[model samples]
Target: MDGLHAPASLALGIVPRKAPALDIASIPRFWFDNDPFKTRFFDALSLLFPEGEKFFIACVRDYRANITDPELQQQVKDFIYQEGQHGALHTAFNDRLKAQGVQVDRILAKQRTIMFDGFRGKLPKRYTLGQTAAAEHITAIMAHRFTHSDVFASAHPVARALFAWHAVEEIEHKAVAFDVLRTVAKGNWLIRAGSMLQVSVTFPLHVVLLMNHLLKLDGVLPNPQVWKDGRRWLLGAEGLLRPMLRDYLDYYRFGFHPNNHGNLAKIQRWREEFAEHGDARLATDRTLHG
Candidate 1:
């Protein structure tokens, strides 16, 4: 219950709800506002989620039996369920990309080889948990920004529903990994801070590189207009990336906790929205293969 607010309690059902079906085929290549750059940008993030969330689940579940608080223990179970559902959903989405002949498998293969397999044995447990805590902060803030902003307003309905739902859950259990870290790793501030620094560099670098790779595959990387629009999409007044920069800085503050951001009202609203429309199918008409 360290970071659980009243609204977040609803997310701790102990069983993870399956994500509503998303019509991955209907999601156009440039799904975000119909802009290729923006679409590719989000695709870059999606590429990371399956593998990344798996690592996060492992980091927290490693210390599951040690969590003494009943509320937190239940939250951890929900967290694992949520993250597992995320990985499965994103995997289905990525499969659609591959069927569309997008070069996504190359990126995913690299992720498996480099991130999942390569780093699995090399990193220490404390470091891994610290990294999980730091990554959760990043995703949680991104969730807040996604929910509050109009960034996804013009996105394809399929992508919008998927992201909006994911964001809500991200906000719901935003503190689970950090709580696990606090309990298991003794909340080592130095390791936590260092992991953030590492994440700040590697996370963005990986996304940008993947975006560029996807764009290059699509023959849009060298186009001047693409970069111009992409820059504004990320850094402009209504840009999604720039505003979150401040949120990212909040992690460096001493005694930072994700609940400090406080989005209960937003969570409540989204919870209602999900309860009403959360079960919508992703792409029932089309068959997807794993």
Candidate 2:
């Protein structure tokens, strides 16, 4: 970590940057090597963010006033800003998907029904925050991979920038929900572990079902080659899931924190790259890192 960013992390936790204005207008439907499976996999995730992030903000907001730590309070404000923009930008991204004849509306309706009507606001505040924290862990793990790895090496420039930028911010406030849970839940391990267990089962199930929904739309579900390649991408050697398996399991460790990943230096480098290159950050940073 550089001199400037080290203290910020220790003192204020992760500092969320101002939300960038990303224009995904020219990004195509199958933006990654024209692969519908890959495209829909991400599209499914993106579709969840708008209302989903709003629920995250709400989860944090419920316990915000009770937080006495000034640092955590500031982090809460930044978390809202970062996640709000994420929801907005993803709404736009989903709009683009709709323009390309993707059945985003159907997917979103299903998500709202399940997330809101089925789950949100129905649980106790602590449990809700626990769920939020669990989901944040998942996103942070994914954010680290997306920004720090070559998983999206062949993705469209716009699409890659969108995820990379979102990834950095996700890393930045990755602990806010968890921290809030610790403060409010009084470090209840059962609640935390139980939440993770529930999230572990439910999240992947949703993603798989949504991915199937998306693939069916493109008539790609019947293509055996698509599943073969997707299986490799998800579970094969050098797969995204395979490398991050330990990181995912680390959540169940007795006393895990999001920063345990030790990727802050990479986050700083990306932040500097964004500062120096503006909209061209991804390309420039790739050249620098390479």
Candidate 3:
């Protein structure tokens, strides 16, 4: 538990909870705050989750037998379950993008090719697992930002409920893959740092590429105003993602553990809501109406 410092209370149970049930048939194209930049920002991420989660699961499970800590072994099982649910739910939502005429399959296909397919068997397993650890660090940081910021506040309730619920679990079990990677790598920081370097370029590039695909589909890729809004919203003075840079950089530091940057305090209320209701819709109603 050297780097696994989250309170025992935070790890109460990492179960597979329901995704917020909303009819995907009628969710408007720009569902978050009616702004193209904001809505598409999330859509871009959603587009990645299916393939991304699958890769993450396999990466960690590859080292499952190496887990020596009883607590970590159990956490690994829960992590697999959680990532499975996230993939399944996001796959269902991607269909909505397909229904909206976005050709999500194309994006997914590209991901399969470059993101995981090309490198899995070709690269050393350690680097891939390190990539998993880095990716998990990034995911956890994003989860933290969403739960603590106004970023998702105006998203349609369906999306809001889904992300908020996902965020809590991500924070809860953020260290599972990292712990697995650390044990397997024997605390060699270079493997992890080298992988982060790879992810640092590729992750954001992939998301922006997906977002561009969506914007191009909507015939808005040429809109200067869209770029302006995106800049201000994501890169400008108070961008939701801007504040997470420090946390992101922290991943490169030696002896870094996810829980060092973790906390359930801000999202504690949502944690209780999910644990109590065990239903996405149930938690969502409390989130929206509360």
Best by TM-score: 3
Candidate 2 structure quality by residue, lDDT tens digits, 1-290: 42211222331145555556666888887998688877888888987888789888887898888899998898899899989888888888889878867778787788787776767747777887888999998898787667555667788877877888888788778888998998755758888899889988988888888788778877777788888999898788877677567778878888787766635656667767777756634642463233
Candidate 3 collision pairs:
none
* Clash pairs for candidate 1: 21-281, 21-282, 22-282, 23-282
How many clashes would you count in candidate 3? 0
Q: What is the C-alpha local distance difference test score of each model?
A: 0.74, 0.77, 0.77
Order the candidate numbers by TM-score, best to worst: 3, 2, 1
The alpha-carbon root-mean-square deviation between model 1 and the true structure, to one decimal in Å, is: 5.5
Clashes of each: 4, 0, 0
lDDT of 1: 0.74
Q: What's the true lDDT of residue 27 in model 3?
A: 68
Distance from true location, Cα of 209 in model 1, Å? 1.2
Cα-based lDDT at residue 3, candidate 2: 22
Q: How do the predictions measure up, each by TM-score?
A: 0.87, 0.89, 0.90
lDDT of 3 by residue, 65-90 (tens): 87778988888988888888888888
